[model samples]
Target: MSVSPRRLRAGALALATLAIISTTACTAGGGGGNANGGAATTLTVNTSFVLKTLDPGRVYEATGLTAVHALYDTLVTFEGSDVGTPVPALAESYEASADATTFTFKLRSGVTFSDGSPLTADDVVFSLNRLKNIKGSPAVTVSELSVSKTDDSTVVVTSATPNPNVPVVLAMPSTGVINAKVAQENGAKDGEDAAQGDTAQQYLDTNSIGSGPYVLKSYDPSAQVVLEANPNYWGDKPQFDRVVLRNMDVQTQKLTMQRAEAAEISLDISGKLLDGLPESLQTSGVQDTVYFLFLNADPAVSAVTSNAKFNQALRAAIDYQGIAALYGEGAAPGAGLVAPAFPGTLPEGEASTRDVAKAKALLAEAGLDNPTVTFNYPAITYKGVDLGTVATKVQGDAAEAGITLELNPQPLTTFLDEMRGGKSPLGFTPQSLNYPVADSLINNMAPGQATALRSGWTVQRADPAVVAAGEQVTETLDLAARATAMQEWQRLMNQSSPYIVLASNSSTVVATADLTGADYSAAGWQVDVAAVGRR
Candidate 1:
């Protein structure tokens, strides 16, 4: 167990190789050092997906989100928990009116955008209402808000009814506060008329302007983005002076780490790469983020196809823990859609674990005997984390459950497009796109809420009763009432539209022996850069 840091670091290097080759990460964070141990630290990180655009509104995918979080800060920093339990970010604190339908935020003053412009209450008003108007943007995000500014430093945001997660949604990186002036200068598209076919400024796609710890130094699209710390950061300044993110192939990233071009290997590695690591790397020092299949069952694809029983059967067929084990030692089986770190969210009763018998029984009830389904996974190429193998195992499990499944692995672009677009009948992906607020996760896939793209899988939306219940849930600011509504919402989802419950990915940090400050706390859905440092 006491392998020298040398032996363990080598193993970590090998694991990094496998992760990079086999799979990709959605939101990249962690790993850095301040060379002089001053307020400036520059560290190189790895990610398979490149930032498509720096604008948060335009590019909403996970990879592009990595850069967005650093470039812009939201009103509420998704703090405390990732599954939508929010603490204050820009708004110092929030208080709900007696009815919970009304909320008032006391803004943090002296906060300026990267350009030395003031971030006033007015910008908050513009950012929000604009989010609701964007035709093709994520629809469910803005459903509950009714925002108005009371003063330059005071903003009162209300829900259409009893809404508690308003602050949580505001904190998500997707809701990063844009400098109203800068947004206009960059030709930032207003969400109000995106579907009207208005061609917004194409240049804003590559440029960024907001309030964050780092400002964009340079970007080469498919190559790399260089970031320099902002001297005027509202809070503690970044430790690094400048950070360089390179977009090398999986293998190249591996070689560079051994050569020390990369002080750390941040991408998930392949199983084969595990062979490259010495035994010490396999120890507890390394961690694993969970992987699961995200299934999209849009009604647009087929009517009988999105059957509740069919969905339930698919959920029961595959073994999540078994699939996780295929990766290595760090994986854990999950029982619900919401990961455990989120409070009051995923309790045992909320989701069902593996039951082959239940799977068989459910499929038979759904009359989906010998059914063939297609599974879409993000195209990954690392050696060890073979989704293909998981797919193959799922196929075998389905066969035993009297169901047939076809497997498809694709690149991130295709996977996200088809999944968010809601074009695919069946696909497997993660719901890791959560904020600190519970509603952030709930609303995304909720009834009457917006679908990621338009997959048309709002099975619950088709039912009016469900819609009313969801609205009533947001209408209450009372903690008890909100919890009740969430329970009912999840209860209905579990009873009717259950996607396969997958594993909650765990965080594993690999660093040089000299590196420290490995504290991992819930900081929104994002990995907290501020929490990272040397021991």
Candidate 2:
């Protein structure tokens, strides 16, 4: 038996099941957690998001990807609101057979890599094939798609199936193209170094060769990363001469934003910071971060947390209001796995409701609500929890549901180790599913102690349904069938909070009056800087 992982709930919902809850009133700002009103001429964005790697192929970490976007561009991309639809970036025009399996792309003629080599069909094929051959970040993104370069200027991508979202996947920076010459000459891996070539870690420490709007200038560990505008950029020149990413303490970064050292401030604010900031300044709560306790779901260590009822009890017991208030600065209550625009997009009280009754019922069903559990939190320097506001609120809420929740905060690396090492009983980490593909997020939704990429969490927890649907969508070269299949996929994830889906944070951004285009989503994914302007 093939296990028929694809058979979700039997009947599929007709194309429309539930409209994706628009977190914003359809406005990027509405869904964003920042008070990004300034139109500064030069944005001095001071973020702790130091560049760990410049290689788009393997830079899956949030902080790393933030820097990659500045120095690289992808083939196909997305516009506002849509997840899979393709929007032009590197590719000027493209043609796909009516069946949607084979796509032919025509690259702009004059585009050149940062290394000065002209971009062409060969480069496109080289990059895609490299990604497919590699075992790192972008590999999963490009895994199922088949590729071929028809000629010097045209590349054809053939999918196992007809997929409308192939363009979206292409748009992803992980699909960012690299210079074949640079990769060859240095005996280095550009991006596909993860599984095969040289590894992103080896390549990015010293080299960056892409056909992006910006070119790499310098990198100094976690201290700083600098990029000068690529003069040979295929697109219009950026408004700024350079973009600098700096590393600083969360509190200092906040202060820097207040004092205008940085053009922007992003928040995944910790309770400790919220309490320490000047009262007047503290109230300037920007919608910046999401706070949710993730269950590592280890059968041996976290049997209770892994229980569906336990997950329900914990979520239901949460006093979303109190925690939000504890974080202060006018933090709003969070709901579901996603955060919605306050007031209009998400009706007031939409996610803030406290259902004590529902919680109690869940705890009783779990038969172990009173079970003792310790949650490992990332450290303070990185805005990791101090275990007071968030954990306390959770502790109190869980208490109401007859469960005892304990907090144990550790350094980021240590906490990461316990969770990834497959030893953590319970870990408090926040996660987001940015692409709208529920299956892609299964790594974070492990029911059996799923390991993260860096940490040892195993990928075995990936539901067969998720895997099948994911695979089918990639291989299916037909539209109606793919759509029909995806509808079922989305619904299954919605019903299964196997990961105990918590709040999807809003990325709050505050910038000096100089830089523009520093929008962070409520979900913390960096904003696309194609149209960004800097003073």
TM-score for each predicted model, relative to the true structure: 0.70, 0.70
Per-model lDDT: 0.56, 0.54
lDDT tens per residue, model 2, 1-535: 0111111011000000111111111110001111233441333445565344556666665555666666777776654223435667788888888777777888767888875678887778777777676666557767778877777878888888555557656776677788876665655443444355554445554456787776666665456656666767777776766566666656677666455533443434333344443332211122333455566444666677667677666767777766666543334566433333211123234454567888888777767646777866665432443444465667777777777767787766677666666676666655434443433333343323233422222346445665565466445555556554544543443334343333433334344434445444321135444445544
Model 1: per-residue lDDT, tens digit, 209-323?
A: 6677767666665666666666566877755566566676556655554554223434433443433543322211222233444445565575434677777777777776677
Backbone steric clashes in candidate 1, count: 46
Question: Which residue ranges in model 2 land beyond 4 Å of their true spot?
Answer: 1-43, 62-64, 78-85, 95-101, 115-117, 160-164, 188-207, 261-314, 327-334, 338-352, 361-388, 408-427, 433-438, 442-498, 521-530
User: What is the lDDT, from 0 to 100, of the residue 346 in candidate 1?
Assistant: 51
